[model samples]
Structure formats: structure tokens, C-alpha cells
Target: MPLGRAGAPVDWLVVGLGNPGAEYVGTRHNVGFAVAGVLADRWSLPKPKSRYRGLVSEGRTGPGGPRVALLLPQTHMNDAGASVG
Candidate 1:
């Protein structure tokens, strides 16, 4: 389950699947993305940057908790595998 640099393995991969356009912003289909955003804010992670064909943010969950990698795929839901893979 690790997806981080060597010696700093990520303990979790939180993925948010949604379409990649403004038209889908607040729709139910984007709920996963919205949740991911809330988690990132709550975890105090830095703003996600474009990477792996998606938006990525990495940080620990509290001081000594597991390391997490949040991903909001920019691809359409049907094509999310491109980003996650």
C-alpha cells in the first residue's frame, strides 16, 4: 500500500473519482472529490499539485499517525484507471 519515497512509505491512498470539468463541480458524481478536499483540509495537507494525471496531496494524519496520499483523479470516472494506475 506504500506509494511514497523510499524509507517514507505512504500508509494510505485516498482516491476521489470524478469528471474533469467545471460543469460537474457540485454534482453528486463529484462527492468523492469533495470528500477528498475536506480530508486534505482537515489533515492540513498542502494544496494538491497536478501529478499522475490527477491532483495529489501527501501528508501524515496527525503527528504520529499513518502517512496518507490523497488523489483526485482529473480524468472522467470511466477513465479513472489512467490516473490511479
Candidate 2:
């Protein structure tokens, strides 16, 4: 449950914002989710799970890769604070 924070020990913080559910898939609004998926696949990371009021996937780039977390907020576009907070 490592989140991105200023002056923290995180290598990088990648955030992908989008609506939840299968219905929004492929739509322009869901580009964030799509990008996150691509990154996860490219990095061979595990499936995202529920966390921080959103779906989160945590993994390293490789055996000794830098730590990273992929976050997709389930809340609406306007109320993304819940996920970040």
C-alpha cells in the first residue's frame, strides 16, 4: 500500500484516471485506464486490486527494477480526490 508522496521514497508515481466498469472500456474518457493496462502488460505486473479508493497494481519493473504503483480511480472524473486522498 505504498502511495506517492512528496519527499518520499518512491521512484515514480504513475496515475491513470478513468471511470470504472466494463462499459467505459475503449472510450476516450478511459484512456488513462487503457494506458495503465498497457504499462502493466509491458512491465508484466500483477493485476490491479482494490486500494486507495481505486484499483491499484504494485510491482517492480524487473528483478531489481524500480518500485512503481499503478492507480485507476473508480470515482467519477470530478471526484477523484477520494482516490488520491
Candidate 3:
């Protein structure tokens, strides 16, 4: 299994559900995605790359905090599980 900076397996999987399109940016529907972006920045994770049909970022919470995996599905909210699964 992939380990975090603290050498621990990922302890959290944060999924941010939203639609994909420029029109949705900054809208209430994209709140989840927005929050995910904030967390990714706060954690200093690498820029999310395409994976599992979504954007993904992985890193630790802090020096010795829990490892986290963040996902922002590229699919619509109803189909977000497709990317997650």
C-alpha cells in the first residue's frame, strides 16, 4: 500500500463531488470541490493529477498527522461514485 510522509497508510479518503465545467466554478454546487482545493493547498500536497477519472492529491496532514487522499470527481455529482470506485 502507498504510505504517506509519516510512513503510514492513508487514513482518510476525502471525496469532493461536483460537476465539471467552467460554468460551475465558484457556484454553490462546487462547494465540495472548492473545499477540496483548500485542503490540498493547506496540506501542501502535489497538484492533483488525473486518476480514477478524477483529480487526486495525497499527503499527510502535518509532520506526523494522518495521511489523506483527496479526490474531486470529474463526473457529475450523481455519478461521482464511478470515479471513486
Candidate 4:
């Protein structure tokens, strides 16, 4: 991994809290997921891929931008910490 000119690792960790699977999609409890999706679009991020025990998308804040890693845990919301760790 490369560090940005900011002098440290310039990265963003955007985590969306929600239950796994289709039944949870668009539900009120998953608002964070919705927000993350919006951010991914706004940032022109790649679609989510399975990694780090979650679904992830990678993007940059702008051209020559800071790195961003958007994460949606596959575990239940209550277990999000496991995926994060």
C-alpha cells in the first residue's frame, strides 16, 4: 500500500451496518448501507467485492485522491466487530 502526500496512509473506512442477505436490503435498519452506496457512487468506486470478511469497494477521494475502502460486513450487525477486526 502507498501513502498519500498527506504524510500518512490517506485512507477512509466507511462501514455500513446491516444484516446480511437480500431480506435486509432497503430496510430501515440498513440506512447505513444506503449511505455507503451513495458514497461509492459519488466517489466513482468499484463495485463491492468479497474481502476482509465483508463486501468491499475501493475508490479514491478525487483524481490523485486519498484511498477509500468501503465495507459492508457479511455478519449480522451485532457481529460487525468481528469482520472489522
Top-TM-score candidate index:
1
Q: Residue-wise lDDT of candidate 2 within 1-85, one digit each (tens)?
A: 3473343354656789888778888899899888989999988978788888898777777788898888889897788888877
What are the per-residue Cα lDDT tens digits for candidate 4 across 1-85?
3322334453778888888888988898888889988899999988788877888887697799779878898889889998877
What RMSD does each model have against the real structure? Answer: 1.4, 3.6, 2.9, 4.0
C-alpha lDDT of residue 61 in model 1: 87
Relative to the true structure, candidate 2 has a C-alpha RMSD (angstroms) of: 3.6
Clashing pairs in 2: none
Q: Model 4, residue 73: what's the lDDT?
A: 88
What Cα-based lDDT does every candidate model obtain? 0.89, 0.80, 0.86, 0.80
> Runs in model 1 with CA error above 4 Å?
5-7
For candidate 1, lDDT tens digit of each residue in 1-85? Answer: 6566465778899998888898999999999999998999899999888888999899998999899999999899999999999
Off by over 4 Å in 4: 1-10
**lDDT tens string, model 3, 1-85?**
4523355568898998889999999999999999999899899989888888998889888998888999899999999989988
Superposed Cα deviation of residue 57, candidate 4 (Å): 0.8
TM-score of each: 0.92, 0.82, 0.87, 0.83
Question: Distance from true position, residue 44, model 3, in Å?
Answer: 0.9
Q: What TM-score would candidate 3 get against the native?
A: 0.87
